[model samples]
Target: MNPLVSVIIPVHNGAHFLPDSLASVFAQEYRPIEVIVADDGSTDGSAEVAESFPGVRCLRLEKGGVSRARNLAVAASAGEWLAFLDADDRWFPRKLTEQVALGEACPEAGLVLCRVIHRFSVDIPEWFYGPTDGSAVTAYEPSAWLVRRAVFERVGGFDEARSLGEDTQWLSRAWDLGISHLVAEEIGLERHIHGANATGLIQNRRVVFDILRESVERKRARRAIR
Candidate 1:
């Protein structure tokens, strides 16, 4: 029997792109999967849009940021595997299927990452983009991850203190634990580059730098311990 996989989506005022994101998950070629959309105090109709889809579970929170929203969703989910997708991004049709196969093939791998195709909502300078040569990207995005629930729990989920870079912080913890991960060569997600993307905001750059500093300190501490 295939293991149950839970797809977690956290959204805030994401009504415009929620439908397409949810549709991609529902179109997955895998079975015994559950989708949970955590509404992070969306004034928009994000929750309603989530509910409109049959079999999709919607959880509402009081604007506690994406980290808290995801943690709550995971706490409520009943799946051996956890897959994350942002409301503005989408998964390829065979995403879950391929990830499951990778999980089975490498039973020791707690996490599986796949390639992502960035779909820009507006034209941007070419210099701003990274190499799109289908190579395995070094950076980790939440939407491209398929992690085991055990690993997620072991890492203590996303850090609630971080309003941004929570995924990076969580993955850093996973790496420190020496958790094994496999990277699938195929593209698994389409990351939409739009104006509202938190990463694109200038003010968030400071948060990014802070996350990097903390990560460096943590790594150094770990090395000293060893």
Candidate 2:
């Protein structure tokens, strides 16, 4: 039997993009997968959109942040592996199949990351960016991840205190615990960049800085202990 994979999508007022994302999930070539749409108090019709899809489990929650919604979905899900997708992002048809293959090949890997292509809503001048910058930011997004449920549990899910950079914090904690990660060369995710993206919000910038500072301190403490 194929190992069950649970795909979790946490959204807040994401009705506009939820359908496309759900379609991508439904189009997956893999079998025995469950899709969990965690609606984080969306005033829009995000819950209705999620419920419109057959077999999709929609979990309604108060206006908690993305981390809280994801944590709740994972807690209610039953799967050996967990795959996360942002409401505005999409997975390629063979995404799950390829990730599963990679996981099987690297049994020691606790997490598998796939290459992602970022589609920007607006074009910027080529001269304005460097090779290391621009749409490459999607490289570190949680949407590209397929992780073992046990390892996720061991890392204690995402940090609810962080409104932004929660994925980074969670991954950092996982790495600190010596959890192995494998990167699949195949591009499996398409991240849509838009004006309203959380990363672009001014308040999230401060949250990002706080997360970075905490990460640096944790690293320094680990080094001192060693």
Q: Top model by TM-score, which number? A: 1
| Worst 10 contiguous positions by lDDT, candidate 2 | 125-134
> Using Cα atoms with residue i matched to residue i, what is each candidate's TM-score against the true structure?
0.91, 0.88
* Model 2 stretches with alpha carbons more than 4 Å out: 123-138, 202-209, 219-226
lDDT of 2 at 136: 37
Q: Write the per-residue lDDT of candidate 2 for residues 58-159, one digit (tens) a residue.
A: 998999899999999999999999999999999889989988999988889999988777676756334222232433323567899899998998989798
- Candidate 1 ranges beyond 4 A from true positions: 125-127, 132-139, 202-204, 220-226
Going through the candidates in the order shown, the clash numbers are: 0, 0
What does candidate 1's lDDT look like per residue over 62-164, in tens digits? 9999999999999999999999999999988998999889998998999999877777776653334555444445337899889999889898889988787
